[model samples]
Target: MTGRGADQRTPALLLAAVLLVGVNLRGAIAAVSPVLPEVRADLGLSPSSVSLVTTLPVLCFAAAAPAAAWFGRRVGARPGISWALLLLAVATVARVLGGPAVLLAGTVAIGLAMTVGNVLLPPVVKAGFGAAAGRVTGLYTAALAAGAALTAALTAPIAGLWGWRVGLAGWALLALAAAVLWRSAAGTADPTGPAPVTPAAAGRGPATGPSVWPHPVAWAVGLLLALQTMLYYAVTTWLPTLLVDRLEAGLPTGAAAASLFQLVGILGALLVPALIGRRRGQVGLGLVVGAGWVVLFAGLLAWPAGWGLWVTVGGLAQGAGVALSFTVIVLRAHDADAARRVSGMAQLVGYGIGATGPLLVGGLYGATGGWAVPLATLAGIGVLYAAVASVAGRPVTVGGPPSVRDGGSAPVGPAPAGGRPATPPGGR
Candidate 1:
């Protein structure tokens, strides 16, 4: 009876740790946009260079993905995640301590740490929750959006009260908290921890079976993720500045708008599990999300004053888009190991493509001296996103034949040898 109670308590604690860690992953990055103006003034950064504050982290997400996966395999997921959180706390503090060079360096460190969390968390969810992976993933994503929203809304006010340095560094406390929680949870029990790699398995390397690289469905999924990631970061990075410049709004007003853009995403993230339950096909959801993006950019271009409606719509779409993309990743893989491999590849592809978004938007704005061209560029990306999502959202598995449809319920292959039965993807 005592053992049963302890077993039950462990998963609850693990879930809590996962949520706390999710909260830290994005808040530090999101803290930048609200105080961008102040950071620019203090650091003497140009418009294009300032965009790097957001862009560099995403670039690191791509650059560090392989290493993160390797690290997870070498050290179990719990310890890897705990270490990443500690590094996140250090990086968050380090970025605030020095000039532009230190700031960018610290940003790189933060990104590298976050990549581990981003890559490992899904497998942990799948292993820990089993049939409830979809719902838990929605919660995880909601936590992510909530953290971003809180930081976005609070940073401006905090900066107004204290300096931007203090406002930005304050988020490190959350990282520290998450680290402690994760360590506590891991100490209790870690069902999701990596299996000990025997000498034979170690010699075979981190991945076995057919590689996800040759798979077209994997590429399509990566493309969908790329578009979603690009749109989310680009908008988050520049929305406040765009509002301030185009509407001649105050910084606080602009920050409030940015906060709305992030806050409403929580609704969108939560909606995904419900949508997955009702909808047979993901193509329609993808199309609708794509349409929302198009409408958001077009609305912004046509009527800058009606920013509230456009931002709300855009925020929901961004949140759903990301959650849906990850859901597909989990649904398509045969097992947790495959999920991690596909995740590594997909994120590498997705974020590598995505990292270009903020940089390009900033450069276009700098070159053209207006938001019109940049907004149109994003809308065009939306069109392409819709087309790609149609393919990516199909009810198919990663390594399976393209014609096979699992109805979005499970992976294609047989259960991994000597492991637990392959769990259904997402919902029951």
Candidate 2:
């Protein structure tokens, strides 16, 4: 009875750890945005350099994603998470003491650590909460949104009180605390810590399967995820600037608008997967989100003062867009190992592609000296996303589970559904 009780408690604790980890990941990125203006002033960074500061993490996400899968196979997920979280904490804490170069380097470390979390956490969730992926994903992503919102909203004030360095350093504390919590809660040895995948599933190298690359679902999910991430990071990096320059708003109001964008995004990220239970539901929501994107950009330009409501609409749409992308990550893969693979590939390609938004928009700004070009650039991506989602959002399975060859997966073939256990393609 005690053993069973302990078993039951383990999963709850693991979930908590995932939530904490999620919180740390985004705060590291979002906090910097709010404090970026001040950091720019302190460092005397040009607009292009500033764009690079925000762009570095996404680029790291792309570069380091494959490594995350490698680490999960070699070191085990819990240990990888622990070390990554510690790295994030240490890097964030120590980075602020130096010059802009140090700051950029620390962000690189943070991005790498975050990539591990991004790759490993979903599989861990799938292993533990097999019956409740949507709810768990919602909770996890909500924490992600909460972290971004909290940091986005608070960093400005924190910087005002102390300085941008302290505001930047503050996120390190969250990472540090998350590290401690993860150790205490989830650092236990096997059977109690993170659930492990089969030897064939996780241990196989990246080439074991042609499942995801050749499949249409993977491309769609990847495309959608990429575009949404591009939009999210672009706005997170530059939204404040847009509000301030375009609408002639004050800094605080612009910061608040940025904060509000993420805060409402939490709702969309949290609710979409749960509320829209059917697989095809995301497809339908794509149309809605597309329309909302139109409204979000257009409404902001047309009724600039009524920005609050428009912000909410835009936030909800983008949030739901992200939520759907994540859902597709889990839903489109056959198992936890596959989840990690799909996640790695999706984020790798997605973030790699998405990283261009900031530079392009910033270049546009530098060239045109206005927000119109940036706004058009963002809206144009939305238009492109509509076409991709129409296909990626379709009900289809990725190729199949990871082929173990002789000793790995058995009878490797097309996944039953788009990674679902029993459903077939388009079955719902």
Candidate 3:
């Protein structure tokens, strides 16, 4: 292809690669949850052992996030993602080939590989898509939710026909395909050469960027992501059982409700980009998402008959919550390097705190023998999430001087190269 022709095609190819990578990020983990019973029975595993298969990846996400950022810095984001996908495919196959020990080991490998993808993708989107980052982020988040929903829905049927091992291992095909596509799209050139010294990096080398952990704005964004993730996981883990116990629903109905919770989230994910285009201040949007969570939990508490409405609304909120959090991460960072650092720090805090949600909700139900207290606790969390989202949604960049004490708002920092403002005009 001619140089101009290749340049024209690169964006589309990169987008396709990104979507494919997003699909593989959660499918392997989601597949295991649906076939846990078969896995447990066949392997003679205890309940805790079975739980580890699902929980190990989240913990690994936390533990490996910094490593992912480091890997991206060395190999560049595209190569980093491609390498991670290759490992994910191998890990998926390995996890299903043997007994319980092999399974758990494979799970750890899957988590670590996925952590690279999770941490690097936002920076890739920012660097590749530029001003259209929010819309691309929405598409990426939708792909993730769709992959998870499809895997969860299909795995049980596949396991019934074949076995749990085949069902689990089949997702390796997705990872392999993504790896091949990403390799082709990214080409052989490594983009990790020295970045231009912009005003944001004035008086400092490219390698000497500030850490995101010390920034209050980064903390706000991380807390919002953490709460959203925690609530989503906790509710997803228990919503079916909650329906069965509280509303006297049959297993089929409960299962359908759970499916709705996953599927409706796609709409929520798509909604964010449109909202970003129309509105400058995201605090109102954040409030709406927060209200969705509160209404879902409160409605379930007051009248369990409205379970359908609650689940649908909660799914939308959960989907939008994640997309918004990542969009903020992209928009708030002055450049791709900052985006990577902030993304890593945010996800480390996010998954680390979120990994406890299922355990906490289950423990509460076991002790209380009812969903009332647990649901109430989730409602309280929804309130806290709303408060944090307000802070996170502000038009403030990480490392920028704070103009307010409560993390309300701050002026954009120095513009990067090409004189483009770090944040887009009107606070997008």
Q: How does each model score on TM-score? A: 0.83, 0.82, 0.89
Candidate 1 backbone clash number: 0
Judge candidate 1 at residue 249 and give its lDDT: 93
Q: What are the candidates' C-alpha RMSDs?
A: 4.9, 5.5, 4.6
Residue 127, candidate 1: Cα error in Å is 1.0
The best-first sequence of candidates by TM-score reads 3, 1, 2
lDDT of 2: 0.72
| Tens-digit lDDT string for candidate 3 (1-428) | 33223224478887898888988898899998888878898899998898889889999988788778777776767677888998999999999888999999999999999999998888777766777776788788888888898899899898889988889898999999998888777554434332343433211223536656767778888888889888999988899899899989899988888889889987898789888756545788888899999998998899998999989999999889878888888777656666777888888888889888888899999999999999999998899999988888776666432332235345433467988645432122
Which candidate order results from sorting by lDDT in descending order?
A: 3, 1, 2
> In candidate 1, what residue range of length 10 has the lowest lDDT sum?
198-207
lDDT of 1 by residue, 1-428 (tens): 23223235577787898788888888898889879989999999988789788778888888788778667766755567888999999999999999999999999999999999988777667656665665677778888888887887788898899999999998999999998887766553334445555432221243443467766777888889899988987897789899899999998878787778777888998888887756435788889999999999999999999999999999899988888887777666655666666777788889999877777899999999999999999999999999998987776565432333233323333366877545543211
lDDT of the structure predicted as candidate 3: 0.80
Best by lDDT: 3
Worst 10 residues of 3 by lDDT: 197-206
| Tens digits of per-residue lDDT for model 2, 1-428 | 23223235566787788799988877788777767778888888888778777677778888888778767756656668888998998888777888878878888988898889988777666655664665677678778888877887788898899888888888888888888888766554422233343344332343334445555566777788888877777776687788887678898988688778877888888777576555543567677777677677777666778889888898998888877777767665556656766777788888888887667788988999987777877788888777777766554444353343222223212346577454321112
